[model samples]
Target chain A: MDFGDSPEESEFRLRLRGWLQGNNPGLPTSSTDDDYWKGAAAWHRSLFGAGFFGMSWPTAIGGQGLPSVYDVIVDEELAASGAPPRPSLGYLVQGILEHGNEDIQARFLPGIISGRERWCQGFSEPDAGSDLASLRTRADRQGDDYVITGHKVWTSYSDDAEWCLVLARTDQEVAKHRGISAFVVPMHQPGIEQRPLRMINGMTKEFGEVAFNEARVPAVNMIGGPGEGWRLAMTIVSHEREPGELGYVARYTKVVNELTRRVRVNPSGFREDQVRDLGWAIVEVEMLRLHVRRRLSDRLNGISHGPEGSVDKLLMTWTEQSLGHAALSIGGIAHGGGDDTALNTYLYSRAQSVMGGTSQIQRNLVAGRILGLPSS
Target chain B: MDVRLSTEQQALRESVARVVDQLAPHAVGEIGNAERTSKLDAAVASSGWRELRLGDDQGDPLATGVEAGIIAEEFGRGLADVSFLGPTMAAELRRLAGAAQSESAETVAFTSDLSSIAIAADGQLSSFVAIDASGCSRALLLAARSDGNFLAEVDVASDEVGLDLTRPSSTLGSPASLEPSGRSISDDDLMRWTALGLSLTCADLVGIMQGAVQLSTDYASQRRQYGAPIGSFQAMQHMLADAFVMMEGSRSVTLHAAWAVDALHPRDAVGAASVAKAYCARAARDVCETAIQVHGGIGNTWECLAHVYLRRALLSSDIFGGAGNSLDRVLQHYGIGA
Candidate 1:
């Protein structure tokens, strides 16, 4: 029930705020993918050095050994201070920590923690967008290596990642889920190719299509043995939907404030309906903040991530879309003509429901898994 | 921060649920039956549920809110015909205004417009409608005035059937004198009262939605369609799931509002309450409608329980103004006009 921060949390927040104020890494100005990744890597290294990276990981694994709330504090501070997004290694680290064996953990944990390596997910394919288990990616066993051949679409950061956590089919005799296995494959091998996907916004080269033609990886790099890919993938998706991890409430607050300011400053003034719509949007953002805080409170109370994450995801989707819609209607029409940032944001909001898990899939998950409804 | 209820609160919820469950079926059966109103009123009063939110326990507002919400939720879930809210809130307001509690059940009638006053002169009062005033002889008028809040007490002249069968309405004629309470209610206290009222209403809406969803889910499991149970179809499951999500959202916001009512500042509590009411007012209606849609023909019938939920939801949605008015309140909190 307590919404305010504890004394210790306040102190941590103050310290993080101070560090961000002094060591903010400005956004990259380069258009080239190489420079963009290099800048992101440098920023990640800076955060790691400043003890802001991997704050919730155990000290034995090169983390700060702080509570998960500290990570939330860092996210809030980073978002509020307009700092460039830190490298997205939380999911990769979670996968390795939860599912990886001792050897695999020892091999990947430090690299991910130290920001010395980058990883991309290789789950979605052309035919297996929502039905991810039906992926046709194949990994045949060899003498000492598994040769992987598949095409991964929408593999974000794959063009720059040094490694990929891939899901490949190993045993065709079993069910679709059981036939799959997870592996850590080197991305720079001879048979691997990455081509950046052109976004509708005509900017940002983060997403790419990665094709692997007999890409070789040592058999020892397999995570959680064979037939455990589905479980591992679920873990990864859960981490991706981790409540309050992205500081979305803070960012949305900023957007709402800016939108309100724009509406107030408009020459024509807000009509009655516009004002009501603005009010609705504002309330939605506040609801999102409350919702996220509740989920975080549950996390602190030892509640594990479950299908409730889908609930938060659904709310986040609605909030972001509402905010974007409001901004465009208010700022776009009021200000008149080409506001690229606003337009870009509206377009990007469309992906929120599609990316992690489509809204339809999320609803299905909530119904089937959470509600125990029968699946037909 | 922990949002989970404490052990004591959990026990309180369980007790309230137990009592309401025991009395609900009978009370729901007595809806639209004037003869049973007094009996139901006596049963609820004997249970001492009205005193839970009267600030009797060390004057802790948070405890009162959480406890009231628990009771209100049970009442909504059971569709119990107990007129607890009006009496409980009137008592709280009287306490805040330093007035003595009325001997009989007191119902508070709220009006947003300050100009629509019921004149009381020469022992005859003007007529004004009081919503959800079943089993209450006295009515407390709560309205917003230009300078501050207006609070007065009057006598109910006649009872009438309302859209919500469970909560019978009454019309209050002008009293012998328009006697305002001696104590003036500050804006802060008014906000606190409004927050409590909205939180309780949200709790009721949450219960109604939860009840409807449970009914639909049970029917979906048993009702056959296309040679199988309808619940097995994705259409039914998704509909029910969406309803479940709305219910959870309403529940979450309402709980937060309830907590904020006692824990946060009055202004913050108002903000939270408005958000909670707006969300629940809209979401509960949607959930109830979805429940009916999932149930199909049976849901449309009078024998089915879906309409009962819808009726209650419709009444509760407009209790403190509908979602639009709640949103307007939110905007006013931000110093925005209209």
Candidate 2:
């Protein structure tokens, strides 16, 4: 079987890599253990201006739509170039256009594409973390606008957002999944509050809580149908976890490079086992790379993200978490004074198994859907 | 980039799922029946799946009516009892090592090893041990050594004193069947095939585990304990969720490895395959245990049939080498010390 890039894909990579050479943001290579988000937003604007972002959206709405491989290629370049992920708004808004209506597209897609507007997902109330469908938030419809009032904790980027695509209960009488509708609620309205949740990284630029009290949004801001938020959220998350093998390959390369540097320096005085551990991590990452690349090929070929996506997430979660943990163990849980790249990695990866639908949820999907296991 | 299997591959997958869902899963409950393994042989002959090996013309052994891996993966999903590895390895021998000079046999044992092939060296092969020959597959042979891989079927008839029943281990005074490496395949090629077979088997176990998890989850949800569906409890949710994630994560790696064999091939397949198998092996264990845990008391009883899946998972996991071996091989391929 041919796993290497096709000649065409090879040519695509050359062109893509060439473009990224000058346009790359060139952050620290060890950002996994460093706060490389120093100029994350400006990096976003630069990448966006280079026409590197939105490579897959229809050109009419600001995308080349050139084989979707271009998007994978670009993201690969972005990661390899050490460019931090753009704002949550950048990721989610374009995501909306892919699944949202034309009206919603025209209103918000351009602003997001140009880096003019930002967004935060208004999901996750205190009561509904993993069981997000059980969230208690409501958006009552008014004449020209809908008044939204709810308490959302751990909204990743609400404070820095111009608007939020809020998932609120529009049909409270219906069971958890049914009655929910998503709306684009403006953040400038009178009744919106955002509070930063202190983090170990202390990067207050992103991640906070959004408490909406009579926040007003245009009635036309409703996306999809009244009960389609579940579908939209699922779609967004699936896409989030399953795209870009090139990106993972790029990351693997970068990590391996870092690992090699560490081994060469030998300052930490690691033994054979530690070296083996480092090597194991590198191999695991490579293994993960192969797995994700296969998925990327499938997705680019117009294959829907199905049980295969679960495989991607599973490998990714373990690889990532393992890398962090390994880094911690080899590099020391808390290195000299205050550095804990590995520790932070370990801590953060704790969420890997838990977030974006926990490991259990993915397994349930695998067992029930992919394997055709009988569910009670 | 996409991770989805192609139409042909998808169809293969469906057929596999159908076979596993309909035939294999049912047959798994009756573990003692030797007839279960041969059932697919008839189907394979009629449907020309066996001919998929020789193909319509046998000119391009790689070019079967379908993708080569489709058959392997389908067998994996079905939990077939046949020795898939022996034939796959033997077929490689026939295709690469010339047909008439060397006779390639499908999964037969105790036929003829090192002592016999070593003395009868005619640039042809006799028998090769399917399992790790790192032991003593060739300790007694010393007359000549082939430059590359050889296909030989080892007969452990004289040495089957304490081999496990589940695994069919045997010892041999002489080689039952053998092909010397006049032009044998590379270690990488064998690894790719082994990885293909193992990854798909893991995929099959994954299927079984998937079924088990569902059965357990369903049972938990429907069966009540302490005035609530057991599934309603947070502890149960966490346990089931762990199994869910394990299965899914295992699947991603497994498919990745499978695709790697085809896509990356010569360079990356070995490492990828090991990782996939390691992940799948471990995941199968987790899935089996969690299914039992989720199933609770009923799951433990043979009458409940939960053990059917657990047994298969355990059996398949150790067949091509267990998790540790797979992991070590993966590390070795990557030049990482295990």
Candidate 3:
């Protein structure tokens, strides 16, 4: 397996790096602030204008029709430059592209591509976090619209979203998984309320508890069909589990390099145990990087996502937590005190396992589904 | 970069797996059986697998480290008592040093502290312990020297007690008054050799863990507890799943290391090898222990293969200086003081 980029990829990377050097959209101060969203939207538009937004999407859908690796190169360059994250509507777009009907695709694809609109996922509920298929959200069909009623917790960017892809029970008589359907609902409707959930790090409005109370969405907004929510949700979750089209390996490597620099600058202040821990943290990050490359290789080779994604998920959790712990250990009390970036990062790392999927849930998937081991 | 094996590499792996599977039954029943070990060693040698690292008329020279890793992994899966690695390493070293290749299987051992060695006035090596010196006719001593490095062929005087019974260990009484193989080895050559050695060990550990995970998975499916299969329990499933993760992770890193040995720069190759070895060493131990835990009482018994895997993993880890040393090597590769 060749690790070096191809000549074309190298050229694309060089061009992207040159672009990033000229156009430095500063890093976001807070994810939930209006300024951040405005800046992010402007940046997203700039990326789309430069044909960097959908590098791998089909040409029919306003993308460059390039290989997925090009997208990854763009991601790496953006991350390495410390640019704010691009709009994360890729997963939602994937679901719509794969499972949504033509009309639904026409309705949502352009807005996402042009960065004119933003979306949030409405899959998780207050009652159903990891066990998402058992959600109690109800979307009863009316004349031409379905009334959505449910509470979704940990809905990222809901406060800033113009629309949400909500999953709700459409046929309560069927099995829990088969009873649900996905719908594209307007977030600014009268019956919908978004309450910003204050995180442990005191970041407000980044993640919100969205309550849908008889919110009416046109029946045409339904993606796929009734009883297809589970499949669609799986598709979205798999995309979410990906390291992004650009990959997070470069970002993680940057963190490691920063850690090494910090340790090197204050060699005497750091304990031997901390140094060893940092060393191992570096090793873990490198392994994670390799794992991600392998996963990308599989994708490029036409291999679909499998139980191996759970392995990647597990590694991501471990590496982020380890890096944060190393940072905290080195920074000690100064980092632990409020308002420190290290403290913020360490606290945020706690959500890595709980988000995407809990580590426990990932392990279960790896054991039973991936390994084909016996299951309860 | 592609991580999947080529068609030829896949064929080689399948053939090696077949050979290992044929000998697996003997791996459990007869530990340290001289006849069994000899038969396996002879079969491997005659199969010309030992010459995999050193190309023949049919293959390219020193470009098959990946193939060697594949074979080594299969051997590890079968717990086969074959002296392929050491002999292959010796032959490669001889070729690099411009010396004649040894015909017999040669076991390579190392000592970090040269002062621990007892040399006679005649410059003959007195005594040294060779770890994992099984099924070999000669022992090659690798040690640090003032010039560059020393690699000398020695004789295995007697067998010694080793935790891994599947592979034998020995103590060398004295060398045959042979001079060092050649002059001081270059840093690049030393790095390449170390990378190859560590990659093989990593592949072996990957195989051992894979085998253990398979055994435990089978046992968990059949072994019932409280009117249900033990594997049905969340605790057992998660435990085994963690083992599977370790096994796959080790497999990924080992394959990359194998590729790096043949394709990457010497420094990068050594770094990759160090990462593979350190990760595999810890992962193998965890997988084997989890296997025993999942199997309950039977797993710990001598009749069961779990302990055998654990022993092999422990021996493999120590052979390449274990996780701590490997991590240090990694740090050193990164230009960090370790």
Candidate 4:
């Protein structure tokens, strides 16, 4: 069992590290600002331009076709260099690459990879949060297009997206899961209304509620055939849960490092519990880091994960929440220190267990599917 | 990096498992079966697992830390009543100090806190603890002289059985004297040795978690309540699943820590092992408790194996220091402490 990088991996890591030294656009501390989002997008474009993004995707999609370890290296180096996180669109990319036909891939993947065309996921509805299969979004068949009418809550980057991946019920006669279908709809269409939601952290534009009223999407944009959206959604969510593929471990490490720096700067300012909280955060984050490395190692060894992504998601949730609590405690935000950055971070951490998949649902999956526990 | 075990390592794990299955105690009543204990002891001694860290001509270990960790984990899984951790640590001390391998079985003595090796001065070994000393006569110590810290051997005095039924520990006893072995060690050597110790303990904790969860899972599958298997309930299933997740995470970190012992620098190796130790030590306790909880009424009984796993977890968790001490090491490594 070797934990050190392979020779090729080591060389690639070195070259990437050198590139990051020159190209890293240091992230702003807060995400609430419009400039932060603009900077993140710009940084994403720069990373794509420099060939540091999409290291694991096939060359047909403008990727280097390198192994996943290269992506792992990119994540570590970016975090180590204090750069903003790579844009998290791997799930969308994978959904299209796996289910979309040749033309759709040729049309959407390059723009997605190059950050030329931004995208947002239209998955959750107000009533269908964890129970996503019960979504009432309808996509009725037309001549050459499907008219989609649905309400999608928690649509991240909806206001900024050029395209949105929508899951709507194409046939109400079949089972709920089988009746669904996936579509790539333009965000600029006339029938789509995107109203930004004010996040608890006071971020207005990071999340939006998009209402599609008979929005027209060409039938060719349908990913796979009808009744494929459930499978596509499942694939997309599984990818979303993977910290290794999404570079979340690095992002958590960055947060923890920031917390560590704060504590270091004012060592006497924090209480004992706060210090211990920092310690817990550090340990949990480090565990996730090592855990992701091991997962990557398993991938290199040709081990495919199934419900294991649920485990990863759960661990990531723990790490983020703990780090968030620690950040709040150390920053003393609850006591009116009024540090917006730490408060924003702490508020954002609450969503980890809810977004992608709830911790409860994840436990159910692990228990029912992975552990073979009989469900009542 | 490839974290999967090689074919030889897998074979080693299987053989160790076979030995444990054949001779290790299967029930609380069988713990003191002298004939079975002797056979297991002989098997372990012949296996040379204790000498896995003994130095070659070039002073490198006979086997890497991953191989030694595999044996430790398997022993932990079976609750094997024979000594492995102590003797392997003794061999590591000897290897680090450039001493010849011992012909007889030996273990290592730690300070009362089990945070470090017991230090000796002027032939007087103070209050100390000998861990994993089930069949050992002598234990290794670090004798601090004006020149440097040298390797020393001390008698076990008497076996003092501890909470862990599988492994016996002798504590709060002064050995006859500290016998200098005429081999000195450096701070870096000690750090590297501690790295191995932490990695082994973490590996052991992972094993304990795996065993505890499997025991609970099997029990839940069979033990019916409310006219159905208790495992059918979401509460019980979620607990076991959570425990399984902890075990898996512990296993992952422990594997890296074990690999880092030989693959990374001494300081870096200690850092990695500390990370694994902190995670596994914390997770092992919760997992064992979850196991006991899953067994319901039977879990509290002394005859049941759930408590045994907890006992073993308690010992391993505190051997090289618990979660708090490990986090201190991690925080110190990160240069982030008051």
Model 1 TM-score (2 dp): 0.90
Model 2 error, position A350 (Å): 2.9
Worst 10 residues of 1 chain A by lDDT: A28-37
Clash pairs (backbone) in predicted model 1 = A1-B2, B123-B176, B125-B174, B126-B174
Once fitted onto the true fold, the runs of candidate 1 whose alpha carbons sit more than 4 angstroms away are A23-48, A53-55, A62-89, A301-305, A333-337, B26-43, B56-62, B112-127, B142-150, B335-338
How should the candidates be ordered by TM-score, best one leading? 4, 3, 1, 2
lDDT of 3 by residue, A1-376 (tens): 5656888889888988898897867744324233565577788889888877787777776778776656557756776776655666667777788899988888788887878888888999877989999899999999999999989988988887899999999998998999999999999989999988888866775688899999999998898889998898987776676655324555566556766777777777777787777778777877776676677666666636466667777777777788778766665557345436556557777887888788899988888887787667
Which residue segments of model 3 deviate by more than 4 Å? A28-39, A71-80, A84-89, A244-246, A303-305, A335-339, B34-36, B55-60, B112-127, B142-150, B158-160
Query: Which of candidates 3 and 4 is the stronger one according to DockQ?
Result: 4
lDDT per residue, candidate 1, B198-295, as tens digits? 88889999999888888888788788878998888887877887888778778878888988878889898988989899989999889889888877
lDDT of 4 by residue, A1-376 (tens): 7778889889888988899888877767545355578777788889988888998888988888876767777878877877777888887887787788999999999999999999999999999999999999999999999999989999999989999999999999988889999999999989999999987888786889999999999999999999999988988898789888778876777778888887788777778778888898988888888788778767765534378889999888988899889878876565655557777788888989999999888999988888877777
- What is the iRMSD of the candidate numbered 4? 1.4
The true-versus-predicted C-alpha distance at residue B22 of model 4, in Å, is 3.8
DockQ of all models, two decimals each: 0.53, 0.23, 0.58, 0.70
DockQ of model 1 vs. true complex: 0.53
- Candidate 1 chain B lDDT trough over 10 residues, lowest sum: B112-121
Model 4 misses residue B152 by how many Å? 1.5
In terms of lDDT, the poorest run of 10 residues in model 2 chain A is: A85-94
